[model samples]
Target: MYSRIGLTGDVMLGRLVDQYHQQRPVVAVWGDLLDQLRALDGLFINLECCLSNRGEPWQRTQRAFHFRADPDWAVPALERAGVDCCALANNHILDFEEEALRDTLDHLDARNIAYAGAGRTRAEAFEPALVTVNELDVAFVSFTDNTPEYAATETSPGTAYVEIDIGDEETRAAVQETLNRAREHDPDLVIASLHWGPNMVEEPPDTFQKFGRWLIDEGVDIIHGHSAHIFQGIEVYRGRPILYDTGDFVDDYAVDERLRNDRSFLFEVVVSPTGDLSELRLQPTEIHDRSVHEADDEAAKWSRGRMRDLSTPFGTSFERDGEQLVVDFNS
Candidate 1:
């Protein structure tokens, strides 16, 4: 009855990454990590780009970049990795506007890939994607605090947007409503996939930490957080884990020499037979030539050290299990 769920930060297949796909096979994007991803019972990632060929860049507001990939290759790339679900409530989903967003939805639907956070309407945007793995029913809901202009209206198409201020009663009420909707499915576990906060930061603000704890109090089993380009620390509250920031998984963005945005982890959560989270294992990974792969020895060492320093503040400890870092919750 145990289930292994794999989670990653952002998976953006657009711009330069898309160009590389033309020269190489779609599966090349995963490099040697393809087999590792497929080993999990379920995998969820924040799909950080729109898969479409239509629509112009969003001109409704001042935007610096727009990411859109051809569905022909992008959808196959996702399928190749055995992506069970995608969190589409990111800042880049509507980079090419509503037309591209609709196309993204259609492409995922054709592949039977469950996605949440963005949709044709506000109500649809807030809906959850329920999945079953090893008889464990998991509910996933996505939300982003970025790009307020991309927020969906009653009749428009956009993402599930919410401000992350815990002090705001309105924000709390909205989250409660979304939780209520997700509870309707009677899921064994509820995962809140959030694309919040600014990018390139090292740690979450105090408000975000409070908010993450509050979400757990409100019945969320896990908080999958990202947006900051660098991975942050892990905090376990009330027997649930909150991944503050997972950093970039697969992207072509320029590397920040010091921050090393390319360094990340493939997080695997082991859910016990009793439906409680048992262990968290992190397999170090690094992006190279627009593809993701297992981190080399040096990169893996750096990741292990950095994670130890970052997580120690929360009183979290880990044991090196070969190439992977293991955190046992039952300890």
Candidate 2:
């Protein structure tokens, strides 16, 4: 009766990626990882784009990018990969303005795919998305620290945004308030899907690390972090796993030669029937031609080595189990 849930970082289905889908199949974005993703009991992703065919790019500030995917193909592509829920608190969610954000919400709603973070109003944006994974009820609360301009107000449509600094009493209180809101769902597990920090940074700053640990101490079962285009280390605080940054799952961004932003892991967490997290399995993956697939030999080797080196400083270790890097909780 064990259940497995898949988690991924930014999955952008706009711009060139959307163009590629026009010529390829709906499942082409996921490549060989499609079957594995479909096999999970539930899957959560940081959806990095709006799903809509309307609306103009935001010109409020000096924003340089606007990402909007046609729901006709994007929705089906998400369904093909068995995406159960999405975190929509990233900077790009409202890149195309409120109309596109509303469209994204409507499309996900129509497909029965739950989402948290950006919403029509502040209350809805701060609300958690609940989903059942087997017999376990899991809750997801999302937030972003990068886009304060996109922060939801009382009656306006926007993202759930917050500043992360555990040292500051206000920020600590804010984090507690967010967790308190999610706790109202009475879920078996709570995941704080955070889209924070700058892009392409390999290591998280000390402030972020402190904040992540503080969130765990406050009650979050897992800290699912992203927004850094490159993957960071995995840290297990107490018994909960903190995925600092999962990197870009599917996108058309320019690759950083040194950081290898094109490579990351498809994370799977195994939960015992009792709802306790048992183990974590990371399947290395690489992005090419706007498609994501299981990493080949050289890429896999690089992924494993990089992940190990990054995680080692945190006192975290991994054991390779066939093609997957495993972190056993029971041991």
> All candidates' TM-scores?
0.98, 0.98
The per-residue C-alpha lDDT of model 2 at residue 99 equals 92
* Runs with alpha carbons beyond 4 Å of true place in candidate 2: none
TM-score of predicted structure 1: 0.98
Query: What tens-digit string does per-residue lDDT give for candidate 1 at 207-295?
Result: 89999999999999989999998899999898788999999999999999989999999999999866799999999999998999999
Candidate 2 residue-pair clash tally:
0
